[model samples]
Target: MTSFKIPSAPRSIQKDNPIKFLLDSETIDCLAHNIALVHPVFDAQAFKRLALTNIAPLGIMDRSAHIAAALKATLPAKFSEAADILLQTLTPPNVHTDRLGLSVFFYLPHTRFIADYGRDAQHNSGEDPFDVAMRAQYELTRRFTAEFSIRPFLTHDFERTLNQLQQWLNDPDPHVRRLCSEGSRPRLPWGARIPQLIADPSPVLPILEALKNDPSLYVRRSVANHLGDIAKDHSTLAFEVCERWLTDADKDLKWVIRHAVRHPAKQGNATALAIRKAAGGR
Candidate 1:
């Protein structure tokens, strides 16, 4: 990891500072509040000390709860410029997945810009350390779903996203594969619930189907989670799909079943649970 010098004032923060100026916007305030909440979870002083020394992305994540709101309010006026700024500010040395997770909102309103950045990152030369660029792509998709309702432009990329996900499922890198599922998941924590996938997740079904038996526990966990998201809206359909593969399912599949079925079972939604149980145990 290169030495990251945190920008004096992140560009996103500068461009969208007007929102900050106005009434102390709810989103910005929320980020401030969340940071305070996270302070106790991890010892702030120790974490900052570690950041000064080791300089890991995790350190940024520890502080991101505070940065999210500022990022959210700071959207750039132009797409190209925004992408350039985000890539410069958030990449390498400063590559903090958790923090980026929060700051990701900075790009939420302009997903196309973020997508372009992802494409550039994929082709650009550098260490590509920690697969940070790939993770940004994932976060971009995740936020796209969460912040904005599914629109035509977003749906247009649905197929491509699924294709990329499928390709990554077989990636030699387990983390990349995990990101594939995580990105596509309907209910990935803090990610958007892809209504298109939820209404008819057929696009991603085949991909998850292929990954149900993935070797990596990390990747398999994401597979289970992706299915679990589908199960939320299309319980019968998701259950049926899972059952069809029951005979082929391995230990990982079982775990997926448990994770994917939790909400339905907890809600006492017999219809969904019955299908889940018939497919397999808990």
Candidate 2:
């Protein structure tokens, strides 16, 4: 298998710089406050203490996990009930993709909360936990990404998750549509790896196809990256998919195919290069 390297972010942090900590103490406390408002029984101070304890030493992702753990500790023991509380506490949904600023990061713990506790949660309402999780992701994704939260469902229940993602392909929210592709990426950076998808990407090909001509560049970009991930392990398959798309491709789709083969084109893969050239890439 060929290698594809993703550059890591700078780990050195200026502890005193407030911007360095996106989910710092104040943010965690704010998260607690929001949950407390929706949930009458929640102890906001206890949640704040648990979420903030030793959080100063952690990175942004770790802080998300830490706070999610605190949520597990203090929230209702039943994952379904806790998920409902978190869902109720969400702020307004976002429509545009950029300029949202770091405030969007506030929901990181919310997404993490679903991922950690909702993976196998059982319910009495005859509603599958998958339904709750996907609904939460649909809503959570509107405000902040649920890409990270959607993976466990993908792994825990592949066919069911894929079906739900397909149903969401036409969702009005671009963020929700983006999740259909980005969440299923075989080699999603800084997210859980789907070894099965990594080994055989045929399953997600339909997803890539459905979103190939998406109106939002945000969604199309994820399709390109999803195809790019497929290229890493299945070069011929990736090139073939791009080649098929190029036959009657539009400007937007042409760009997606070009980007899909970018890394392999750099690595001198003949098929990738040919696909790139055909897609009008320099």
Q: Which candidate leads in lDDT?
A: 2
RMSD after CA superposition, every candidate: 12.5, 7.5
Q: Return the lDDT, model 2, position 107.
A: 82
> In candidate 2, what residue range of length 10 has the lowest lDDT sum?
1-10
Show the colliding residue pairs in model 1: 61-99, 145-192, 146-192
Return the lDDT, model 1, position 268: 90
Residue range 1-282, candidate 2, lDDT tens digits: 222111122234345765437787767767776776777689988988888889887877788899899998998877788888888777678868876766677788889988877766453244457777778899998987988889988888899999999999998888999999999999999899998899899999998999999999999999999999999999889988998999989889999999999999999888888888888887
**Which residue runs does candidate 1 get wrong by more than 4 Å?**
5-153, 271-282
- The C-alpha TM-scores of every prediction are 0.51, 0.90
lDDT per model vs. reference = 0.49, 0.84
